[model samples]
Target chain A: MDLIQKGKNYLLEDNFQIRASDNYVNIVSYDKMIHFDNKEVKIQYRNKVITVIGDKLVVSKLVSDEVLVCGMIQKIEFR
Target chain B: MKHYIEVRIEGKNIYRFLKRLNQAKINLYHIRYHGINQAYIKILKEDYEKIQDLKTIYDIKITNWYGIEKGKKIIFKYRFFLLFFLFGLALFIFLSHIVFDVEVVHNDKKLRLLLQEELKKYGISKYHFKKNYDEINKIKKEILYRYRNNIEWLEIKEVGVKYVVRVEERIISKEKEKRPIQNIVSKHNAIILSIDAEEGEIIKNINDYVKPGDVIISGEILLNDKIQKRVSAKGKVYGEVWYKTTVEYPLFYQEQKITGKTKKGWSLSLLNKRIELFSFSPFRHKKIFSKPILKSNLLPISLNYERQKELLIIEEALTKEEALEKAISYARDKIQKSLLEKEKIIDIKKLKVDQNNSKIIVELFVTVYQQIGMEKKIEEIKKDVRDH
Candidate 1:
């Protein structure tokens, strides 16, 4: 009905999304984050799980539905 | 939505504070670990306000603000300077298009005043907006047409912030048919060499000697010793005229030689007073060249450059031959200027040369063949006859 609601509906179509680069990690439409530390972070969305392992891991941006992580990222696993 | 503010958090468990902020759905960016018990993080303004509820768990303080808010503060501080700069620019643009002076370029006082008045009627006076080329041309045509008899040609030119109007006056020549009967008389005492009559009868022949005011051609037409009609006399009468001239020349002359020493300086001249902008010259004699910074006649400001040159005055004596030649040529030139354009120097003879203490004086007699006829109105002749 409104512009903001329409945009939210489009972004939330996917249950969860994970994008990782050399120094940054972005998670979109995630339900919640389970564990976070300097070496590893675990996020939960729908019926799946996402884990990120890096050195000096810092949460740069955190919102209701999106998360941005920045560090010397080493590996990322999903289940 | 991304209004960032640097916040310093002081607590033993910084990680716990960060995790709580993340769980609260606050957007955080650029989080840095300052020390074991303190950390710095950038967050949105809205999120920072919401995080105040957790002040009991952690000590929080905002260190700095960034982005658009900082730019707004700086602009507000220097608002006066910005307004003054804009006002100055507007004034400069407005003044550049205004005419400060209107100059009518003419030698006659009456014509200059007439043109000035005419231009004023067209709104082209001082402090008025300068007209474009097309408007100036239209105004020129209108003025010329209004005073067709008085003005033969007109032009308007823009120089700097001034307008220059140039005009030429029309002169009406008198018609010859309306003039009275006249005779061609001798203007000088000379012997007639030849004659060419255009509208009059030749009265004098070649080799005939005539005095001043004597008639060389007659305006009266005769038929069998009877007066028929009268007309204006016109003719050219060539004759041999003589002149005697004397000239004196100095034997010794003093000349200046430049020593090539020069000094450059600037000066400003206003009316009759001049102020030097640079240092004064040590040399006594110098030449000055000035160029105006503002090329307007109403503004008397200019930049003057003075060049000082050293002069050496030396006296030199002329030889006898040189002195005699100088005196002779001076006398001849003086006599030659009085002759007509078609005249030629028939003979030149030296009468005498008197050498004084410092100068030589020469006297010469020159003979030239030239036109010696001039018109005399019949009414003037009748007045002279009645007086006699």
Candidate 2:
């Protein structure tokens, strides 16, 4: 059981995972949301920055390890 | 995990408050801003307690409880109605399996009563719970086997909530003809035309004129002129018989004619009572035909259709020839009904014709070739011999 848990942790070693679709954006293991508004959302994870630009963007779900952004997504950028 | 509370946070810095709540690891869902200063958020009931620290920074109030808590509240409020609905459903299911009526279909009263008793012995009477198909079939076999000599076939059918038992009774054929000491006597005053003796001596010859009581066939058997034995006499004796019949007919006859006016209606028949479901017939003179629509065999209720047709009555005068022909045919029909199976009319002659006020009366003599023999017991003949 210990070996299985360590292997699972290694497979999920990525600090932040970002997924974007036609109308929504989902980010997992994000450090914090630096900016959130109607037009854009800026998120910070580890040492990288992720930005989501959309219209009428709303935070549909916000939890400890993940956030779900919904509504009319236009672009996404990572730096 | 499913219980939730809708909280409305009213403050100038609601976004900052949301960020702070997210930092505090508070899960929020379905977050919507009502205006610039007020926003609504749904959170788990357990997580709602953690938002107490934000009371100093923003005003938070629980608007409503949802999910399982809301369902529990509504159920508690209408508990009596739910209980009654469940009880009614259970009663309906239970009553559907009960047999309200048992019907034994038979024309003979004694047989019907016997079958009813037999069915009762198997607990298949009224007010009993209906048995399943396999059990009913088993009971049917058992009963049929018990009365195999009397019952030809048996069937138990369920119609709605009633059980209808249809039974076919065994028909035993008649026993063979018994030969007793008997004699064949003339049934009418006639002249014997032919005689064929099958089991006895022919006492009367052809062209013999005899009365109703004359013996046509003798049951006595003789050897050397002594009565050796006596047997029942069986013979076919054909004779020429005469009948006088009088028939009368009015010159004017009234007949009913259909006028083609029709009306259709429906009725409900329960037991021996009938209730009309539609309007009655408007025509005064009409013929009515009723037919029942059977929805189920177990239920006594049935829908019936009644069709009524209007008729017209008309009178017409008959001619002389028509009146005589009609009178003769009416007389012939009356005589035909009384004739035996092998008897036939040979000839008819008009004896007299007379006319009264408005009717004509015709008298005729009809000749018929008929079996004129009938059996007479031989014991009566022996009694006469002993008395003499």
Candidate 3:
């Protein structure tokens, strides 16, 4: 990519920015959402899995480059 | 900072639908799960039509709008109502400030007419709007200054879209001591029509030609060719006067007539440049008249309304007789403007006619019945006699 193109696409990278809290979890640069339900939300980044297990889980904001999951977050596991 | 629309999607396995939307590179916001197969999400406003183009089993219902688009949506929905309200407000302001009638309160009909004419010259006439209170006061001061000799005081009072004018006439105390000797003279050379004398001896009989400045009513009372007493002449004389004029009119006439079809529309004006808004297709040949609907003092923007009227032209070739008649009436109108309301043309005669290649010229001799009395002081007559 050109210099300007690389700078504009800063959010679309190989890694992810995962910020988890007691009530919510925000993830940036997630590749895809593999599974979604009220109880669990599983996302992938470069063949790795990040599962968010909680009650009444909701993807409050969703995009290809960023995702914000807001709920009563109980556990976050990366595999 | 992007505008969005809140939509609810309902179908079997809406999770797969969200995945399908993401694969299509569409962004969704605030995805709240309502059931196992339904959810509420926000998408970019421009992406709304793209979502409809996907054409799936999902039922997408728009619930609300977000960001700047929300304000625009509300405005578009109630545009007609807003337009009506603004027009009504402008009409109220235009009606309240307009001068509908002017009334001069006086017992003397002549003084009242003189004052009304003076008021008309100062922009206090009917159906005119003003700029500011200071300007109206300035106009009032101007009228009072000009009439300071004829009137002692003049007051213009505005009462509910009308002007009530009150005036006091200037009367000199020295002139009221005795009978000021005066004579009534003819203002124009004319044949006397009638004489109604209340205080003077009539010197000119009916059908007698009296020239300008000639004494028609003498202040001297004569008995057997000798003056016995002198008094002021107080009377009215009606005379027949003549005026000669020529008027030219085209023999082949193309008259432009108004079709009476009118359409009203709004426009925006900045300085001298005007842009019409909400206007329909105009007539092929038309005239536009505009008034301000919304005006701002601080900004140069003003909303004005333009009324367009259709015009139609009819061509005809007049005969010699018809053209002559037209020229005669045209000459009468030219002379009628200089006459008072009570004075009018009594007779019109065609003196001569000169026809050209494309035009016809007619000369007319017109007669009018008018008041020909002008008061003159007897001292001027005595001075003339001593000088001669």
Question: What is the per-residue lDDT of model 3 for residues B1-388, given as tens digits with 9 covering 90 to 100?
Answer: 7888998999998877887787788898778778777888899988888788773889988888987788888888998988898899999988988899999988899999988887777677899863356876787678778877778877778888988888888876666556678899999989999888888888899999999888989898999999898899989998999888788899999989999998888889998897878666867777889898889999999998888899998998999889988888777787788788667889999888999988998888889999898888899978977998
Residue pairs with colliding backbones in model 3 are none
TM-score of 1: 0.47
TM-score of predicted structure 3: 0.49
Model 2 segments more than 4 A misplaced:
A1-14, A19-25, A33-35, A39-55, A71-79, B1-14, B29-42, B52-82, B176-388
Given candidate 1, what's the lDDT at residue B69? 62
Docking class of 1: acceptable
lDDT of 2 by residue, B188-244 (tens): 999998898998888789999989868889898877998887889998899999989
- Could you tell me which residue pairs clash in candidate 1? A60-B28
Candidate scoring better on lDDT of 1 and 3: 3
Q: Where is model 1 more than 4 Å wrong at Cα?
A: A1-10, A31-51, A77-79, B1-20, B29-48, B51-74, B104-112, B132-134, B150-160, B164-177, B181-388
Where does the lowest 10-residue lDDT sum fall in candidate 1 chain B? B287-296
Candidate 3: where are CA atoms >4 Å away? Answer: A1-15, B1-3, B32-37, B66-72, B103-112, B152-160, B164-172, B179-388
**TM-scores for every predicted model:** 0.47, 0.49, 0.49
Query: Which is superior by TM-score, 1 or 2?
Result: 2
Which candidate's DockQ is highest? Answer: 2
